[model samples]
Target: MTRTLLLFATILTSTQAQQGFGPLDPTPPAAPIPQILTHMAQQESAFANARDHYTFRQDVTFETLAPDTNQPDGAYHQLTDISFDDAGRRQEHVVFAPANTLQRVTLTEADLDDVAHRLPFILTTPELPDYTLTYLGRQRVDQLDTYVFDCTPREILKDHRSLQVEDHRYFQGRIWLSQQDHQIVLIHGQAVPQDTRPGHENLSPPFTTYYQQIDGKYWFPIYTRADGTLHFPAHADALSQTVHVRTTVRYTDYKRFHATVTLHYGTEVPTTPNPPQP
Candidate 1:
């Protein structure tokens, strides 16, 4: 018989604990940050790439509050199982998806992309040459001490699908590294939010992602959250329209997975079979 185990609880991140220290309040980075940042970026890239082999569950929720009254207006939630197919492709099966008032507003694909890939920026060795780094001193996360760094993309990248907007050009944000292991424990930042190209105005709320040690080796993203104002061009009614929103996603149920194989011998052998010698 096989047993099922629960590894960790769902992570609900709090920004209040993160605001305790500024990047340069007490002191600045020690020195030699450029080389250190590059090395750490490579490690982070390897870490993110390794997660495709594991299967986990994600719980995501979105809520909007009335700007006039600050009351909850609408909300939607879903629980999905993220796994890989035999061909080595990622798949998300929605275990739960509840209907809500989110459909009333126009949510473009770009808006969804902003929340998905744009916010959780991961710096790798390949992408390092395109950006510059700065030391942001130290910060305390829970009981662990971490080194902070500011990352800014040097040049603007052209959009492949459509005309480029101001926000789609660069990546500007901060990353937290564990002082002991140099693994990225947290990241707080977003894409440039200065898009003003007519109907293509791209606005993203600054979000923070927290990573936890898995199997005492690598740190993986376990929680992500953002609470900020969302402006849509389709907004007409002030009361019914939602400009302020709270989005939180929790990842849990981390279980190791590997393909199972059965070996066939020439014949079945019993453990307690009589000896061949007579």
Candidate 2:
């Protein structure tokens, strides 16, 4: 009996060694290039044109890397409720701005528009003609394996396809698309050079956005963070200060206009919407 027990223990140890005593993971397969790009373009357009189909709250926080500031020094938050305005045109309201750090920055309306929408990096159908992409490899984003690619715009021309920042400003970036669903899971990089543009020279900053699978169908940009240095104009007789800046945007309180059911305990249960309406 003792000899048999010893042999069993040795076999178990050898089996564990063979398994490497780590997470058992299968290698991700290569993505089908054309299929992913085509399907991704369609989904992006679907999400883009779904402006009125969904409404959620956005909270943005920023901190200037001043000598004494470490946490959030300022914040610009708002609830984007979709509804027909008095003029019968659909509009979203900036229902909240807890702290006026965004005002302190004094960004122009166009600049705010770019930040609120474009910074999140949505590659819609109209924007596809503007970029050229190269498959890099496969990368694991959290538990999801993603196909990596290096994307660059063909050019920044007026009336031509580009990111459409400012009038003719164009941005270049890399994108990580999910292998299973062909959704853009991550985006990294910033606007091309802007030094010659004069007033808008330092507006662009490097950032990364992580997309979360929402409603089991769409990959929504649930969180985005940008950290970089900026030189904004100073008050009279004062020189512009070069300060480190970090901006984080979070999306929550999702409300979808549909009913859904999920299987639970061998029975179907209604999945509640994201949260209670404010």
Candidate 3:
């Protein structure tokens, strides 16, 4: 009998109330829901574009825990710098990567992709139509007031072609938007459409991502954490097994990239503006 362990992604709830904030207020927002959603979509779209101009470092850690003792049995760690070249082309440089030692589960390409992209979980104007966002209420997160909304995919395509391509996964969960800026401040959810086909079970755990304001303009993902168990069902000649997984990703050292160009003609001098000091 052969068993395979696959790890994926998701989000979890936060203990906001216990953190000294008031409970979620169920009263309707003063502004129209449609208006609020529109504003959020626009703001998020701008933020997404702005993020591409910034360089940052990402550190990821994944661990598999022993079932009985809840102690780490195996782990994986990597540190990567995401930046741009002189030509302004994006580049990824691995600064540190330790050998993976996890025996219970294996990280799939989808899993790595999720850690790089989906874990940050941005919902811009173009992605708005793919999801149904429901206004939950208003809530205060520390010093900031936020609008709470439940988010779910409108549909998960289950056709044979789409399934084979593995392209229908979507984020399903809740988000907190800053009331003043209409920008996403936090996200709690998981990727959807987990493949449970016999002989091929892929499960994801819930996660939570917190954001911090960057340049006092856009909110950016700063930390993400997921801790849960995946139950792989029994298949032909294989027995069911549960694997506990924990993952944390940190995005830091954000520095915006500014390109400078200078051109001079015959007997002409061009003055290039000084680049901003780091």
Best by TM-score: 3
TM-score of 1: 0.71
| Worst 10-residue lDDT window, candidate 3 | 3-12
lDDT value for candidate 1? 0.68
TM-score of each: 0.71, 0.67, 0.82
Error of 1 at 260 (Å): 7.8
Which residue pairs come into collision in candidate 3?
Answer: 10-190, 10-206, 10-207, 11-189, 11-206, 11-207, 12-207
C-alpha RMSD of each candidate structure in angstroms: 11.3, 12.5, 11.9
lDDT of 2 by residue, 148-190 (tens): 7777767743324333345544446788887887878788877
lDDT of 3 by residue, 229-268 (tens): 9999898879999999999999999999877676567865
lDDT of candidate 3 at residue 133, scale 0 to 100: 91
Q: Which parts of model 3 have CA positions greater than 4 angstroms off? A: 1-21, 84-90, 157-165, 260-278
Candidate 1 wrongly placed segments (more than 4 Å): 1-31, 84-89, 156-171, 232-242, 260-278
66-183: candidate 1 lDDT, tens digit per residue = 7779876888787989876656476888999888666434445565565445554566677778776777688786767788778776653333334356334445788888877677
lDDT of each: 0.68, 0.65, 0.84
> Number of backbone collisions per candidate, in order?
0, 0, 7
